[model samples]
Target: ALLGQQETNLSDGSQQRVTQLLKTAEPGGLYGAAGDLSDALPYRDRPGGLRAIAQVHDRYILAEQPDGLCLIEQHIAHERVLYERLNDRWQLVPLTTPVVLEGLNEKQLEQFERLGLAPEEFGPNRWAIRQAPEPLRDRDDLPDALLELSLGGNLDTAQVAIACRTAIRNGTPLDLATLQTLLDDWQRTRNPRTCPHGRPICLTLSESSLARFFRRSWVVGKSHGI
Candidate 1:
């Protein structure tokens, strides 16, 4: 399948040895069998030259590399994906309840108004979740979450920070189906490059970049060396 390629090549003997090693690397031997067998088997193939393959199983997402195995928090990935989608789709669903915020000083209120949220939308005394965005409907703790945000002075930046925290936390585990859905949604995002807080959502390292990290070309005094 040629998952990836490298400038260096393994000898025929080494390739044969790797094939032999893979024969014994059964479902339980190295990478556990959990997801669809079709997706699982080829990821463990020897001749494919895979650098890594990450998959979500029943209870965990595992990353397999030649050096070692790693268990990743699938839920965090799902949350990031979901949050990105929700943020993009915000205008699609109007606020179900008009949220009245209280406790904001004049400056805070001014900031909120500048951001397009009116005092009426928030309600009297700066308190009340008369309506909330649809994505947050299923989150039972949302009211309390909004209250905390209001208490903190209703600064626009602070409000966004609170929304991010309420969206999702790291370390949640997701099933294969959920992971697939999350990834699919993520691909659809216009700026899948970064999260709402301006943090990078994912990173990519090409073969050339990896070679520089190891100073491979530098050792040979090549033109493109590190």
Candidate 2:
């Protein structure tokens, strides 16, 4: 099914072509083709077809299509993937650090309590390091990490954001093996499309859609007498 809202300006043919391309393109890879009307389009240098762009505006996944391009909100995809991964990894191996957050107000204490976090056992800004969830390890900066975690109001939101930041920011560069493992783990997740904060991982477009956007058919017809 089409994942997001429809654009108004696009003709029916462009939309259909976009749908078909998205349905067929390989997962986790970008695809592109050069548009014929390179001279007319402002972004003439850009390649055409389905192509995923970097995360923009923290919301949408901008992708170049044959006709034009599209934006898929990132948060939707981010939340789904992060939630699943956290659950899966935690089930296998719980968070090792047992992060101890200090100087919590009554509200913060209550929040952690609601999350079932045992504050008493953590021992005053010194949470014990134990088993870290997958893609995480017992790092030295546990204190700072916990401090950051404590900022959010709710346990679920705090934990999810912390986990995502941790996973993304840990110093160790992921090797090919690790990258593949991560991808594999991510795929196994219930909602591989999004992260914990509800962001889409990627977006797509198609070649035919791009061609129509630049009125290439009209140009060709005029030149060749269609």
Query: lDDT for each of the candidates?
Result: 0.45, 0.48
Report the C-alpha displacement of residue 69, candidate 1, in angstroms: 12
lDDT of 2 by residue, 184-206 (tens): 34445565544665434544343
- Residue runs of model 2 more than 4 Å from their true location after superposition: 1-80, 88-101, 121-137, 152-155, 169-189, 192-194
lDDT of model 2 at position 55:
38
- Give the Å shift of residue 202 in candidate 1: 3.0
Q: How far in Å is the alpha carbon of 71 misplaced in model 2?
A: 9.0
Report backbone clashes per prediction. Answer: 14, 34
TM-score of every candidate relative to the true structure: 0.44, 0.46
